[model samples]
Target: MKKYPKYKSSGISWLGDIPEHWEVRRNKYIFQERNEKSVKGTEELLTVSQYTGITKRKDKVLGENKLLTNASSLEGYKTVHKNDLVINIMLAWNGSLGISPYHGITSPAYSVFSIRNKNENFSNFFHYTFRTKIYHSIFKTVSTGVIDSRLRLYPDDFFKLTTLLPPLQEQIQIARFLDWKVGQINKFIKTKKHILELLKEQKQVIINDVVTGKIDVRTGKPYPKYKASAVEWLGDIPEEWEVLPIKRLSKAVKTGSTPPGADDKYYSSEGINWFTPGDFSDETELRNSKRQLSALGVSAVNIFPPKTVYMNGIGSIGKVGICLDSASCNQQINAIITNEKISPYYLLYCIKSAKQFIISFGKFTTLPIINQEETKSLIFPVPSKDGQKVIVSYIQEKTEATDRAISRIEREIELIKEYKERLIADVVTGILAIRGVEVPEVIEDIEEELPEDEPEEIENKEGVE
Candidate 1:
């Protein structure tokens, strides 16, 4: 990275300093808010997202898009043209704003802006600059709101903010440099992400095999005597294994309740380990939650003892976690206190192995939910208590290395993303200059190398099934 020939103080605390040649201009002088609406509102719909920028609504396949059905006509929707910036005013503080590459209509609640000087190549420069955390922080400070999601970067206040305007040619060079550098970084990240996914899938297969008795973990061999599992998804199990419904194996299957939200006395910084599905990753133990419950809150809910397994019965269904200590969960979760016949760890693994089947019983309406009856009726393959212990221990030993590898790769991806963000901020702010720099030809057409499909059944070379 190289610096500019001269420097000057930006005066703005967020933007420390910039190249002396850069001009400090109010946004109003650089951009004009556009309010044009589609007469028919039939143009391709578009959306602004923190990750993807402005993309056609049809192209956003990862998440559900809420459509306005009550609108008698599309005439009220705002029109956005190419090169225009669309800001989801309420979500601007979260970086849900971007430059549009397609002509389309968006929700009327959004704010649209067009560069005032089209010849200046400022659109690309501003696109990167505005998305920086520094700019988002500024947006949050100026926006009128009590909380982040409610913050609104209105046209009046947005235009009042100052921006650093580098020379036209310099802005183009910086943008081009970033386009190449970020592409290279993203390629590396994609590769690591694919590896992480395969590792997780591999771990899931191991859990499925050991818990179902498909593999005898102690001897690293397939069970000699097997019988039909009766369930289609669960092919076969050891002849001695029993297939029983969850209701038969648990002393009690109960759901917890939330304390009254208006009562602040029920919440605390430290107390019982109150958990939600969001608090723990799948198959992990629940040690802590984002929100803890006071003694009163715990008393109001059903508090299960340690080693009890919690499964999310609604919303994100089938995510299983073991309670590390006595804990209470919200109504969305179902806690099972196992009987003497079943090991809690064994039951947890069985639930994880049959996750997809359990999830299939969920009724999808406004949200996905599995009623208590459905949860209790779900059957699983169960081995003897001693056998269950062996299986659980085997799974822990087998997947330890895979889990560590996944965590390391995930951390690497995070570092790469952080570096990408810093690189963009520094380049666009003129802290780093790309003057006469030669970008590699490989960067011009860099594409992510996708990981090969992982085998559904991973074979152990040492003869473990």
Candidate 2:
């Protein structure tokens, strides 16, 4: 990357200086605010997102649904046209503004603007500019609200903000350069993400094989003999293994309850660990939680002893973790206190293997939930205490390498993403000169990394579960 031949300050402190040939103008001079509304309630509804630009509401693939009511009239809804910039007032600081590629209607709460400049290339240039970290900071300064999420960037305030504009021809070159460069970076990221997914899947397969006795860990070979378990999902297990209901193997199985709301006396920062499904992770043991309970809160709830296996019975069903210390949980979790017949670590693996089956028993409503009785009735394969210890040790040893590899790949992906963002910001803001620069040859040959000796014919199983 190279800098321009000469530079001059734009008089805006955040902008610093730009190429001498470029011009600075307020947004009002470059864009005309559009407030036209659709009379009919029907129009192709569109949504604005921070990840994706303006897209059909039905085409949104991420985030929760916020459109709760069906309005009888869309006369109050704003009409948006292709190439028009749409800003979600409340989320503009978070990069929820973008140039629309579709003609539609959006919530009246949003503001719409159309480029007034005739060059046509300015739209693409500004698209990248507005999404830069610099502009996001500027938006935060101008926005008004008590909290970040509630902040609004009104049309009046937006138009008053200063903008830097490159020459019409230079704007086109920069946009075209970025489109190619960013696309290559994104492809590299996608490849890394796929590799991370494969590592995780391999770990899961190893766990399943050891827990079900499909493979003997000590010998690293499949069992020669097997017997039908009669349970469909469990399929077949080693002849020596026995399947039993969870209730029979556990001394107690129960769910906790939340105390009354808004009671400060019952909540404290330095109390017993209060576990939630969100606190559960890939780790087998949980030593801490996002929120802790007060002594009063623990007294009002059941505090299970250390080593108790906890499974989410509601919402994120099947996530399991073992308490490293005495902990209390909300009503959404079911804790199992196993007897000497079962190893808590082994039970955790068994429940994890039967995740889909446990989820099937849940009642799907606004939130899915499995009652204590249903959880207790679920069947689990129990091996002798000695066998349980061996299986747990085998899984830990086999998965440690895979876990490290996955963590490394994940960290690499984050670094790559950060680089991509910085590159875009530098190029779009005129801090780096894209003109006359040749695209790197390495960008074209970036290949997806895969495990050694894996069959290319196998379908690429990508993404973490």
Candidate 3:
């Protein structure tokens, strides 16, 4: 990382100074808002992300969550061409804007703009610049909304912002240098993520074996007498254990709902803990939520008691957690308030072990879903209350070391991502010059490569809408 030979004031306070030869121009001079509507709803659908830039909507890995459809959605979608800048207007302040490398139709809600004077400017260079933290802050200042999530970056405001222009060759060189470096960094991230997956699998195996009686947690020895659990997935359990449907072990089994309407008054900064599938992770206990509901909102949804076992019933079906406190959830989750017959921790472990079985019920659906009836009917091997406690404690003690290791690895991945963001901002803003950097030839994964055909012709005739 090296600095430019000379620098000058950018006139833009946030930008401070830039390379002497670079030009500062209003975005109106650099980009024109694209208003082309898809004549036929046959183009590939695209989505913008803060993390990965522009990507095919279908290619996004949203766990088992598939995009739910609406009637004739792509019919009036905005058409985007290769290199056009696409912004998720509502999320522009969060860096949800990027240069599209594919020709596709995006949501009518998004704003699409084409680069002006393409021969003199490079889209990739500005793509890097616009997505930087500095620009995100700038977007926040100009965006119009009462709250952060609702902030919108309309076309007029975007056109008024000043942008930097580097020499065309230098822009190309910087973009190439970043492409190579980012590819290398991504490969490292992929490896780290794979390790995380393996660690999770290892923890799952331990839970699966202990909860299913494959491993005797009590005496660390084989059970003296074993009996067939009758349930196909349960296999066998200790002779004293009973295989019971969740409905029999819980006093109540029901679902929660979102409050009607999108009004801000329905939500509050200090409202009820409202859990959603998005709040879940690789943790047994569910606590904090990203959004909270007001007292009025609480009246619209069911409030389950503390220690209730909540299992995701739609999209990412089968993911389970026990509420650490009284909480409310959306309709996509089934709340099972257990009775004296079962230990909440043991129920959590059993449900975690049975995830694959629960998931199998929805494998053929467009979106994975297991309604309340289906969830209540699902069976689990249950032991005596005291026995369940012993097993839960044993499992927790055994998995403590593995959990610590997972946390450390997760932190490392977070730091690496932060570093990548900082590097992109520095290089794009001319703070760290890549003018003479010799970018190495990097071979990206086959999946990451763009199609060889003309982008506009790369169509998905049967669109999701």
Cα displacement (angstroms), candidate 3, residue 63, comes to: 10
Please estimate how well model 1 matches the true structure, expressed as its whole-model Cα lDDT: 0.78
Model 1 lDDT tens row, 88-177: 887787677888878888878789999999776568778888989888889999999765435678999999999988889888777778
lDDT of 3 by residue, 1-465 (tens): 789999999998999999999899999999999999987868998877666778886775234544523434568789999999999888788787899999988888889999889898899998889989899999999999876656888999999999888889988888888787777777777777778889889899988887888778867777888999889998889898899998899999999887775467778888888887777777888888888889888877788888988888875677788877888997878899999999988988888888888878654334567888887888999888888888888889988988888888878877877888899888888898886667767646311222211121112111223
* Ten residues in sequence with the least summed lDDT for candidate 2: 456-465
| Residue-by-residue lDDT tens digits, candidate 2, 161-227 | 9988888888877866776777787788878877877886788888888888888876888777889
Instruction: Say which prediction, candidate 1 or candidate 2, comes out ahead on TM-score.
Output: 1
What TM-score would candidate 2 get against the native?
Answer: 0.70
Provide the lDDT at 46 for model 3. 85
Query: Best to worst by TM-score, what's the order?
Result: 3, 1, 2
- Relative to the true structure, candidate 1 has a C-alpha RMSD (angstroms) of 7.8
lDDT of each: 0.78, 0.78, 0.80
TM-scores for every predicted model: 0.80, 0.70, 0.84
